[model samples]
Target: MHLSLVTSVLLTFAVFWNQIEYQQLIGSWQLTHFEGMEKIVNSSQYQNASAAEKAGMDARINYRLENTVYQFEEGDLLKFTDLENQTVVQKEAKIEIKEGNMLLIHEERGDRLAKIVEFSDDKMVLQPISKNSVSGKLIFERIKK
Candidate 1:
């Protein structure tokens, strides 16, 4: 009986670890990397594009990925910075986590960015589920002030 109780406790901790990870996100996180993204952006077609088109793509990519930061606060308040140190993407958002530790940003908008592939106190990685396209990944690391 004692052994069974101990086992149950350990199992509980394992499940709750994801919740603890979410708590750790109540701070600033900077975009660090995106898994499989380089393959898409640096593909032959992208490289063969005209210089002007390349510049346009570069601008969109930078705004979405490079130097982008997110601040998550208590009560599900979130601030997104599409371009670092510039205009704010959104001043507020209500976030939530559904089954499988899916991070739902702007819940009211019905945006489902599912299956946070990996999460830790210092790092977070997310990959959105898509039916047609191969959705890439997003990685963020906690930014210390």
Candidate 2:
């Protein structure tokens, strides 16, 4: 009986601690850098692409890295806002944490899973694990209120 009680207490503490850790992610985060674009641009596929195709990819990456803000709100709400236009591009996203450290973002467009590579009070790095078009570490810094 004593061992069972100890186990239950430990489990409760673990769940509580996990909640506190996840709460750290609830805020606005600005994309500071993207590590995968360089690999994409330097790939042979990109090397042989037409000028227009290469330019388009470059434009898209620039838009994502420079103009995107990811907001993780309470109640599992997620938003992707464009900094340039000051508009929310995706307002219907829902967030979930699975496998302890994997962040699952569900959206109408698609569901994406990213491994939480590193997380702290003011910074986070996510390594994309889903089959998204983009592959690389997304580095973000918390936006101060």
Candidate 3:
């Protein structure tokens, strides 16, 4: 009985903790790094790649370019900015927590499950699953309250 009570309390605590963490994401975040694409683009392997492969890689990299910012609004609306094209795309998404460490973002584009590698008030590191099932790391810093 004692162990059961302790387990119940722990579950409750975790729920509250996750609520706070989820709320923190309801703000602006700017992309600071994309190690996955950057490493491939800068490495010697890129030089040997065929033109088509290069183009495909470039297109994927384009979506996660530096200076990109994402604003998560209160009503599940996400405003994403692409600095290179100076374009802003808005989509409604539902954020769901999967297994405590992953966040599932369901939107018009598709459902994306991102692993939270590191998260704090000022910074976040997420690894989102790409179209080809490849995972890409994205680092971001808070830009607005």
Most TM-score-accurate candidate: 1
lDDT of each: 0.74, 0.80, 0.75
User: For residues 104-124, could you state the per-residue lDDT of candidate 2 as single tens digits?
Assistant: 888776887888877889988
TM-score order, best first, reads 1, 2, 3
Model 2 segments beyond 4 Å from truth? Answer: 1-20, 40-60, 82-88, 131-134
Using TM-score as the yardstick, the better of models 1 and 2 is 1
N/CA/C clash count, model 1: 0
* Residue-wise C-alpha lDDT for candidate 1, range 52-143, written one tens digit per residue: 98888777666666647889998877787654355545556778877667777774456656577777778888787767677778888988
The C-alpha stretches of model 1 lying farther than 4 A from their native spots are: 1-13, 16-21, 49-60, 83-88, 130-133
lDDT of 2 at 109: 67
Model 2, residue 83: displacement in angstroms?
Answer: 11
Alpha-carbon shift of residue 35 in model 1 (angstroms): 3.7
Least lDDT summed over 10 consecutive residues: which range in candidate 1? 82-91
**What's the TM-score of each model vs. the native?**
0.67, 0.65, 0.63
Q: Between candidates 1 and 3, name the one with more favorable lDDT.
A: 3
Sorted on lDDT, best first, the list reads: 2, 3, 1
Q: Whole-model lDDT for model 2 versus the true structure?
A: 0.80
User: Evaluated with lDDT, which candidate comes out highest?
Assistant: 2
TM-score of 2: 0.65
